[model samples]
Target: MPTPATSMNEFLVSLLRVPAVAARDVDDEGRTLVSNDVTGSSQLHEVGPDGTWRRLTDLDGVAAGRYLPGRRAVIVQHDAGGNERGQLSLIDMSEDAGPDVLPPLSPLVHDPAFVHRLAGVRQDRVLYLTNRRNGVDFDLVSRELGTGVETVLYDGGGYVGEVEASPDGHWVVLTRPNAPANSMQLLLVSTLDGQVEELTAWAEHTHQSTPSWLPDSSGFVVSSNAGREFTAVVRFDLDSRAWTSLVADDEHDLVGWVSPSGEHLLVATNDDGAVGVAVHPLDGAGDPRPIDVPPGGCAALNRHPDPVWSASGRALALTFSSPVEPLYAVRYDLASGSLSALRTPGAPAFPPGLVQPESHRVPTPDGEQIPTFVFRPADGGDGSVVLVVHGGPESQSLRQWNPIVAGLVAQGHTVLVPNVRGSTGYGRRWYSLDDVRLRLDSVADLAALHDWLPSLGLDPDRAALYGGSYGGYMVLAGLAFQPARWAAGVDIVGIASLVTFLENTSDYRRSHREREYGSLAADREFLHEASPLTRVEAMRAPLFVIHGANDPRVPLSEAEQIVAALTDRGVPCELRVYADEGHGLAKKANQLDAYPAALAFLAHHLAKGDGVTGTVTNIKEDTE
Candidate 1:
């Protein structure tokens, strides 16, 4: 047999952010599309309806590009400084031409307070939010494509997010952030007069949210946890002050765009963690008709607006993905309930010899049944396994794409991700079971998986634990709380000391942390008891920590404090901090850099074969 030129290192290159569908026009424009690959490095790949793909841009780090309305050109965001800061660029698709780097609306050197998400385009202008106005805070701004003159809009000091413009271009709707849970407030901003008006007051105990306006502009639709166990969509009667729930799911409901025809509503749901998209009538109690895309595990469903509507109100294009599947854009014909793949993921496919996941129920310490997903090597000849504890002790492990998991699996590691106690989609009781005093319950659920793994013939001694954010905190806690369970631990931006994490977080995040972990000042004893940093000496496994210097949620201090304590005790621990990252790695290059380092660490400490024989190297530097 011809030797496979692909090494374990090269097997994971495709796992990085390879583009599936690029710069797609609202409608098929002569079948013109843009996509990319790993080595091509984010350059636009033009695809035709016939499946022929060609590169349209050679620029390095072409962040994002989409078709411009009323024009034959494609507007793109480009990384000018090679430091992950992007500038707007234009690509004329009318001719077979590459992109042109337009003048930036802001300086390339200044770092953004957070990742920038693009709102819809105005007349030849792009509206975005940046920290230019408040320095420490963000503000809405508009930059004209004709002249590149940036105009600052509302000062986003107060809680403001998800900027949406109303129909007829008359008003702008934004979600205003209030302390505690995110309370949605609808604000109408006049484009002609520049006057702002408050449309609604803070709904009490109501998780506030405002969706897009109906095509008739009769009223705006908002989704919230009101009068329901899970989130539901409601139409707020602007004149009557009445709210009506249009649709509701048992535990998780996500409302997408209202059909342009004003007849149907598309909803994505987390029904016991099996996610799928559903279509329902505007006003009815009938069961919603569901369109099966991918398995809901770790998947996010998004419906596009202004569907082609070849069959009146039924057919449409949608995007879907889970942890196991990469993002894929597909055309769904509601009439036949059939899905056709419009775009497929390039390179970095799932590890070649990994088995498609098999789901099972594991019994938690408290006798609660937890759902678990296991992805093993195809041969199972490799006895080593990795238990990936998900973040959001409140968040469940659904089907989703995780480059880190893919990388380790490429090297013959069986990856197991579990939805423990406190995870959503299970039920209200299971989720709240891990709150505050019950938080240790999540660790117990992991323990159940540890005991259950050996029955599958995998070696427990070769198994390790890895997670980021809340998952990261679990890594340390798993070692501290149950030191004998894991061989090694990789902590990515995880919490070490619950008390310090809450006390030192940004004012914005500090307000929310109280709800999840309890108040640091009021619950000092509980905080100390739950903290991994306070019990670092109990950790016996080799440890690795990666943090973003600019992370505001779990600050760099979280990484520093734990590393300092472990090092002071002469424990084997390694830490890496990136200067320009935040809560998560934003830059694709940075992720590419970090994934390999993590894989090598796991292999060094946990892999049982030749992989552990000096294949892993640790490099550490002083961030201070």
Candidate 2:
């Protein structure tokens, strides 16, 4: 028998060994195609009804597999070095012919500089979104599967949020994001006549997404926050240009799916941070009935545009994970309302009774109650705490399977993750609280959370700030703005300077980021003022910085500039750069190297009586 994990490294090893199903899709034959990390690298794997897993690809990248309509083969989206520029390759499941990159779909196969997203692949045609034209905005394009003829379906500008085709293949719905404001509009395009009709007007602060067509093709269903504080299921009519609210709730955001037959719609709503599923009929006959979801965290049930309804429409597949549970591909039977696990590869081996996080509301000075999750050891902790802030200022800190938090808890440190004012799932007003000039308000909220930790018996002064991307920025901000509050900090691919990040980020993602952060041209002064680099002089805590050299979102320069400044100021700092990764550490090998180093760094600095300071470690570079 394998020995139980006792040390931090051993605990991390056991947790990371648990494979997570990143993306999954089911076919007509009940075979499930999943992209999992069972082989250290996230590759394509097929799971049969007998629960046997067969590896499909051995590539070293993140692969999201989806079976074609006829189930003859699968189309996999693969990206290299953690870059978001994904390419589509068709894999012949029968002959083991490996994955073949379609020439017509990917004209520049050798170049990994652009991003290609598969919208929908039918029998004879493939629709996708690409920024090949200007590298700034994604354009909707389609290619014939047999003849290799590529055609531009929509040449409209701005970021294409989603591209979905009708079941009949005569119409396509495009979701175009209007940035600098958290909103998007839907456009309906006809394939035969090339006519485009705008379904939604350009509205500020109104968010709309996940459009599913009705079986009859007369209209479509979408989740919209228009004229409401939370997202609601709304039905749109093509002929009358009318929108009717199908399901509305003041407290939750409704996200659901309309069956292929158009008889019933399944809507998932965010009850605070947890997911709740409700089924409603399309004919406006009766009240919406609730569908039972498995006890644990549901992966934002309504987040995906395409619902994973089985070919028979009797069952739906969903990916779910909990604080102690590894991600699993589960199937929920519509008729019986029963949820069964289809693939739980690494779950059984994981030790039971891990630390369960407790939800709390930390009140900020501005009268906002931040939703926070605290993970502590059974014996409380060693008094020191590590605050793990999440990215996407717009994203919420959900209860998911996170090895990093578990490892921190194993090391006798209390871990606190907070969903601050800007986090989603609370409501639109809460999400918009940290925009532009008010960005630092969210940072102040973090300070409030730090001040409130003492009430929970955690030592406030002995805390360390940890996060990546935007959260990484928060780490730097926590040290700079509230220097005396934290003992140390760790930032992974975070932004040191907002101005440089916005200017250097990929063109296609610039506007979407600008919507969260301020615009470069319009809010130049405010952007620079909110940057952590501007307040670097106030940073007294020792720091550890980790970044990917190939990071396209927050470039490597963000790490380099901050590290150089901290080192020159005689502040102790450590910098690690991985040449083979991007943004965050995606590959398991890189993660093993980075996360362990992070835990060690925190232990050395934030440990009870470690007062050692002013010793700078030389920059370490990993090319693995």
> Where's the lowest-lDDT run of ten residues in candidate 2?
101-110
Candidate 1 C-alpha lDDT tens digits along 1-624 = 111324655666556755444233333333344444444354555445555555556664445555566665666565532333345556555554332332222232234344343555644776666554443365666668778787665664654656766556666667665442324566666666777766555543334443666666666666666556676777766568577878776756554556655677776676655567777877775777877765654224221122222223455555555556665555555668766665543544443443356788887566778788787665563787888887776566766556666666667778888887777655455666776666777777767888888788888878788998999988888888887778888898899999889888865556456766777767789989989887787876778888877676788899888888877766677788776566756556676677667777777777565221221223443222
C-alpha lDDT values of all predictions: 0.63, 0.79
Query: Cα lDDT for residue 580, model 2?
Result: 79
List TM-score per model, in order.
0.77, 0.94
Span of 10 residues, lowest total lDDT, candidate 1:
302-311
Over all chains combined, what TM-score does candidate 2 have?
A: 0.94
Error of 2 at 407 (Å): 1.3
Q: Model 1 residue 448 lDDT? A: 85
Give the C-alpha miss distance for residue 378 in model 1, angstroms: 3.8
Candidate 1 positional error at 26, Å: 3.2
Q: What does the lDDT read for residue 327 in candidate 1?
A: 54
- Candidate 2 per-residue lDDT, tens place, 19-91, comes to 7774467765657777677667777777776677677777656777567777467777778887878787776
